[model samples]
Target: MAESTLGGGAQAASTSLKNPRTAAAVRLGLAWLIVGALVALAFSLHETPNRGAAASFSLLIGVALGVTFQRGRFCFFCIFRDFIENRDSSGLFAVLSALAVGGIGYAIVFGAFMPNPSGRGLPANAHIGPVSWVLVAGGLAFGVGMALSGACISGHLYRLGEGYTRAPLALFGSLVGFGVGFLTWHTLYVEAISVAPLAWLPKTLGYGGSLALHLALLSLIAALLLRHLPELPAQAGGKLTWRRIYQAVFVTRWNPLVTGALVGLIGTFAYLRVSPLGVTSQLSSLTRTALNNAGWLGDRLVGLDGFAGCAARVVDTITNNGILIGGLVAGSLAMALFTNRFQLSRLTVRGALTALLGGALMGWGAMVSLGCTVGTLLSGISAFALSGWLFGAAVFAGVWLGIKLRLHA
Candidate 1:
């Protein structure tokens, strides 16, 4: 009787596996399991001597970032494309929201860290870069690359987890571009970057003035963008339940403001704890290390190491950025799977070529500029660096050109 009952249970399990609903349930279960494992790994890393708590925190933050990026559709290129192509400025507001929130948070943190804003010394590890034509050129290249590749560097990283087949090619192209940047670093540095002025808003305007100006600028942008935004659909009113909550949190794309605010909070915490929110340091480091090892790159990259957006360096083990990236991918993958959004697509030759070309341009631009959108633009602007505004403007112009040329096609 016991054997017969066991046989019946096994048969039922097999039948459930064959059912589509059951299979989906199984997939969700697996995703949850993986997420659990990631959390456990973070804890374990905290206890480990080599990795330490910082690595653990970075991993967790990365996971949060990945989830946010995926849910919010926080790709800068996507945001710009939507506005340029569809005249939908909703996403732009998200970007503004993030910047505003981050700026305010940064201001408080800056005050605590440095009592006097009008000082000769800059805040430690802020994204303040020298304002120069070199920066403009880099930003333009980065923007064009985004259009060609169909995503920014951070976008590609998160999208990679969603089974974006072109991500690998784009990323590889970036590595090559980084290599090229390393080759040309000395000349650019000596010619322009060395003499360029580092413009920090607080250096001249003081914290209060800087924050006011930042908020005012964002508000103006927001007001201008209002004309482009489509009328939002009226939300259906209903009793809130666990299922509704689940759908709102996991199934639907998040509201832009909510998404931006969360992103702002994450960036703030990231800066307060580990470092500023940049994604390219590890990629650059890897590229630099590879080139140096191959004897193609010199030991010193001129004044490259001095300015701090996302400083790349040679390293034996995975750095905090690396860990963050890992968590980002993993988190995105889990979310994708849970949402039934993970699907592998076939890559055509034309698609592959464009991705590679675009990636290369982006890589070169990021290398030259010392960061990409997240680093130089978002983080830099949050820190009130004029270079951030310059880079952002150039990137916008580049994207516009790319769109006009139909490069994304």
Candidate 2:
């Protein structure tokens, strides 16, 4: 009997060693150790006097972003598309929760930034663009691009880390589109978008009042969204314990509401410290620099540096934005591996074509709108920018149109 029991134990040990999940967990652990070591090295040995802190902080935030996005599956395109196609309101509710939490965070941050709170001047670096035809056009294009490409800019970055082959082509298309947008920027800025108003709710209503109104609106929206969603049954479980917590966080998908709240908090912290939550400025910089080196882009298009939003600026080394992006990719990749969700899929010819074209449209749209979903919609609305609202509505409309036309199909 003892010999038989020993044999069974040995077999079980061997089986555990060969488990794919165990292998994935090992890989994930190694990746995180490497990440931690690198971050520590940067913090300890960075050459810059004052910039090290910001860069390190940005990378940390990026990692948080990547992890949250991967676990929550928080792709804006997927969220809306799921609801439209299958009546899944989970993502929408998550979005509302994020926006509500983000609004509150922004309000507090804004109050701190401008101690007076009732001052006439807007907070620095807010993404409040002029409301005009250009904004609508940009939003529509962005939505269509997202639908066709299967992801947004942020989505592409994190997905790329997961070995999605199509993401590279989409990102490359974005670069080309940005170049095109720059070529026509002068005409657009002068003729249509330059003179539009930069509207902020806080300026007109004050911080407290704006907060109250936004909270109320968000509550109503959440309530309506709940009406559309069927209730999920409560799971039968015993007392909450450490193993359960670990399982919830690492072994299973996170609740969207929880994920959204964390994302909002990260965004708020990021903006307060480094800049607004933009991922494409680095790509824009690369494109612009390449154009300048080749002398294709004129000097007139170099005016974005003076702007307050996520405008591209030339840099010889990695900027904070680059660091944040890198962190996001690496962090998400680690998490995906840990969860055994890291996958690499080949693209079909049609899919490849769609990715390229969709990427181009997204790039152009981002340039026109001065931000993508993260920059314009998420960060902008958090800051109470009217342009954010306009752009978001337009994006929804475009997505609906694309779905109706079977763009993704």
Candidate 3:
């Protein structure tokens, strides 16, 4: 059996190498195209109406994130569901690794920003929001929406690049949900969030202390999860080589751990260079802009600008958020094509409807919570915000209930 397996593996490798010239040409062409497009985008941003290096930088960050996500399959909803339904903790471990890496990065960043971590002054513009009932409700709704739509907002973005038919409908529903969230934002803000507590771990523990405690906690969690790491059936001889390395890194799926670490690094770099990692910020802005233009959303709700969250503001020009989202799609598309993974999808009526409804839930949940899984749960935890943990638990619970209800079944 071992000999046969080795023979088969060698045959496959030889077949792949047979068309080396064509494969190399295709790969190089794709690489050049990606680089050219990025350069063009940067130049265009410089010459455009909202001319700034920031927008270009934001797009670059998005591209990195998109590539990482597509390559890693880093879907929060999927991670939770995989664990809940199949006891597959690999995806969950990826998520934890990302949080751990991001936490360390954020701690260093925060320390640099505010020398006195325990001082009354907080790190500027961290996503630490009030832990309110609305947050719980929003998280629950977001998770449910993820189950229905088959992905989260970030998931939909990258999947859309891969020709996922449901992504469009889900994203469209998210827009509508944002509109709904806008209509009720004033009440929620005034009634629930305004009076809620903002608990930042660094405020209590200080920067060094918070880093130590969180690292310890993360180490413990990682150790526990390590016991459950999937053990593949003992294979015959499968020797690693340079060709295999290329396939593993580019043509084949990356390890979740490596993907998570890359994601964490991207998130950290994004915060340091541009803004925190988020997808729905652009969606909310688009919704607000549309409503404002339609005269449905008046200046009365404009007070959201003062808040710390991914608040909406209507503008005619393209925003950094838009650039980020556009880059995500473009990056994913490029990667998919290069890897021969791009394909069009056609969805059934039921699937389409499910995606739309799920998207709407996600939008509403994001509006209430002021972020999605990426922005709220991941980034929040990285920033040492208690709301991140709370929102994350709520999202997990929602996913659990959704699976229990047989949403995926």
Candidate 1 vs candidate 2: the TM-score winner is 1
Clashing pairs in 2: none
Instruction: Assess candidate 3 and give its TM-score to the true structure.
Output: 0.89
True-structure lDDT of candidate 2: 0.81
Taking the tens digit of each residue's C-alpha lDDT, what string does model 3 give over 1-409?
1112212233344346335544445555775698689779877886776557788888888888888888888888788888888788889878888998999899888877888877785678788878989999999998888888888999999888788889999999999999999998989888987788888998888888888888898889888877677874453468988877777767767788889888889889888877888888888988999998899988667446765667677877668988889889878877776665666787899999989999999999998888898889988989998988899988888888888997755
Best by lDDT: 1
lDDT of 3 at 343: 63
**TM-score for each prediction?**
0.94, 0.91, 0.89
lDDT preference between candidates 1 and 2, better one: 1
lDDT of each: 0.89, 0.81, 0.82
Better of 2 and 3 by lDDT: 3
Q: Any runs in candidate 2 off by more than 4 Å, and if so which?
A: 1-22, 41-50, 117-120
- The TM-score of predicted model 2 comes to 0.91
Q: Please give the RMSD to the true structure for each candidate, in Å.
A: 5.1, 4.7, 5.2
Model 2 Cα lDDT, one tens digit per residue, 339-393: 6666687889998999899899988888878888888888888888888889999
- TM-score: the better of candidates 1 and 3: 1
